[model samples]
Target chain A: MIDFSNPLHLLAYGVMAAGLAFDLVGCIGLVRLPDVYNRLQAGTKCVTLGTCLLLLGVLLRFGFGSMGWKALLCLWFIAMTSPTAAHAIARAAHRAGYALWKGSVGDRYAEDDEGRNIQPAAAADRPKEA
Target chain B: MTALDVLMLGLALGVFLCLYRALRGPTPADRAVSVDILGVLMVGFCAVMTVATGKDLYMIVGLAWASLAFVGSLALAKFLEGRSFDD
Candidate 1:
């Protein structure tokens, strides 16, 4: 049983609760979002933060013991990797010709590709060299 | 029930939601995204288990899981891009 009288334990409980809520909300978004990109946006950001917070709670609970050090290490690993993975997935999806949702506003990657292939328009868009 | 128990139950529910998305997603990318999220959620579960069991091993497991998940996601992305792995 956790000692609720300890300030650290209380803090750990609060942090863990917040992390749990975030995880649930992120998963809900994953299920309910309209498109792949939308789901990726929601799931990656929220879940990464949630998991990091959960690890932080563990660190708080254990202080500077071995468990706490390991929790902190895990926290760093997840934080570094999650967003990079999300970006890679998004880029791959786009390159694989996955269509954006009908309500999507812009595709910078497509625009860049077009500019690269059609130099005249790209040149025209650029300022004239004096 | 203690807060840890509630936390574990909520995380389990979240895992189910992720599983639903992974299983029923309309596109491969959606499935991939859900799988990535599932990996992250598992790390959280490991953390909770560490606290519940008062063990350090779960944290090590979470660390290894995070690394492997990242590699798997990157490989999936490369496969989706239709590119050679070396590229």
Candidate 2:
């Protein structure tokens, strides 16, 4: 049972507000972003950080307990996994031939994938039928 | 009976709002992102519920849900790609 009069309670409130604010801001990025890849950049990284802070606040208020530990572990798991998952999604999108934003100057994945293609193994090999 | 309880309840409602977004999302990617966010929100909601209810048990359920949410999202995304999970 938390004592609302306790200063620690104030800290908890502040943490919750800040963390939720960050999370909502990340959502705004999702709504406003130009493309899926760009949205992934905002959504995965920012939301993970926001939720981690929120969990940390919960941990602080709840004290050292199983729940606290579980929260920390969950935060760590999300921090590691979310970005990797986003990367995988992006790679899949690319492979499925989703075009990059045309006005954008760069296409690194296209270049890298093209570089790996094997041009018809020595074109001269005795096949004159056309 | 308290301000913390009120605020926690509000957060829970906010979480539900996020959940609505997750369910009706327009794209697989949107749904995936929402599921991931919603998992964290669920954890946050459970933590606050623990505080509000003075019971730690809900946190365990929340954590378990988080794990399951991850697996479910991964499988859904795989399914979208026409990949078979049974293999």
- Give the number of the best model, judged by lDDT: 1
Docking class of 1: high
lDDT of 1 by residue, A6-28 (tens): 99999998899999989999999
Give the number of the best model, judged by DockQ. Answer: 1
Candidate 1 chain B lowest-lDDT run of ten: B78-87
Look at candidate 1 and give me any clashing residue pairs.
Answer: none
Q: What is the C-alpha lDDT profile of model 2 across A1-130, one tens digit per residue?
A: 5566888767866776676666666666665665656666776676667777777777777777876787677677767766766676666555544444445566566555555772222222323323
Candidate No. with top TM-score: 1
Q: Candidate 2, which CAPRI tier?
A: acceptable
lDDT of 2 at A78: 67
